[model samples]
Target: MQTVAFTQMKDGTTEEYQFLRSLEHRYIRSLPERLEGALQSLGSGLQGYQISRLEHSLQAATRAEADGADIDYIVAALLHDLGDELAPANHSQFAASILRPYVRAEVTWVVEMHGLFQMRYYAHHYGDNPDGYLAYQDHPWFVACCHFCERWDQAAFDPSYPTKPLAYFMPMLREVFSRTAFDPAILQAP
Candidate 1:
């Protein structure tokens, strides 16, 4: 069917719902391309940094790869700041939600909390509590989030870092996003 017959969700027939589901699955398969476009847009995002947001992201992923992190961590590093443009106020959570259905729980938790953990680097200068992340210190993934910020997210701003280009990460991004959505095996706690 070209379009659903129903104008509202409550009126959708079984066949129409199935058709919509097929369409959605096709759209889902294209996520990596959409994400590539989004990352490209970040080239013009928030200024003042020596590098573009895209560069920061590329650098973060490059560091993750160099450190021998698994695909989930590398992809997480690449996308950790994707919401910086549209959800600057809660970018971390926004990015995490995008990744929640694909990556491990620990990765999602770290990405969700990276913004708070990152405060330790600059919040004190703004009179905000740098120790804000201390509240989660006892959580299982607290150290992982701390390392995410300290080693990748917070440290990826250098203009001179030899970061891999976006093309270099496309395959990895495609691999991760192509995972069966919300697969229990993939999302299970690490």
Candidate 2:
């Protein structure tokens, strides 16, 4: 039970401390410290911290864990965009493949839904036609994530919250890494 308490995030003004808690507490403990470490080293969920998909994933994971979702669901939320931070352009499928070994269909669905969700939201909000939106419904994960996103997005920070540009985020990844797991050491390795 390595309880790590973290300070409030970049978008927040308040100083708060709460231990990182997960729903499948027992399983995570035995999975290897590297799992959490790998997740922690991941930083802002994408290569550039400013992108913020990963930070959002952490927030979403924290929310899901507290809500008592299953382990697969918990990891899915935590790693929903695990590949996003790496290849922002082609990450959805990459993330799914990366996680295939460690998780199950439930989590995989969420990962797959991310693209559909973003596509549909962009089209519905901007484009007049729903040609792209219609395709999203065909993805079962899209439906599940839509419902889940609705619940947690309320607490998600603004995309530009840290008041810094995307380029600056890469440098600040140390800050991102440090806060995620409440340990600065994870930022040491490549």
**Which has the greatest lDDT?**
1
Whole-model alpha-carbon lDDT for candidate 1: 0.95
What pairs collide in candidate 1? none
For residues 1-190, write the lDDT of model 2, one tens digit per residue. 3533444455332232223334344444444444444555566344544435556666666566567776556555665566655666766677666455555555555666566555544465775553554566666555676756555433444564333222322322232222323223422312
As a whole number from 0 to 100, the lDDT of residue 26 in candidate 1 is 95
Q: Show the colliding residue pairs in model 2.
A: 45-54, 45-85, 46-85, 47-85
lDDT of 1 by residue, 71-166 (tens): 999999999999999999999999999999999999999999999999999998999899989998899999899888999988999998999999
What lDDT score belongs to each candidate, Candidate 1 first? 0.95, 0.51
Candidate 1 stretches with Cα past 4 Å from truth are none
Total clashes for model 1: 0
Alpha-carbon shift of residue 63 in model 2 (angstroms): 1.8
lDDT for model 2, please: 0.51
Report how far off residue 113 is in candidate 1 (Å): 0.4
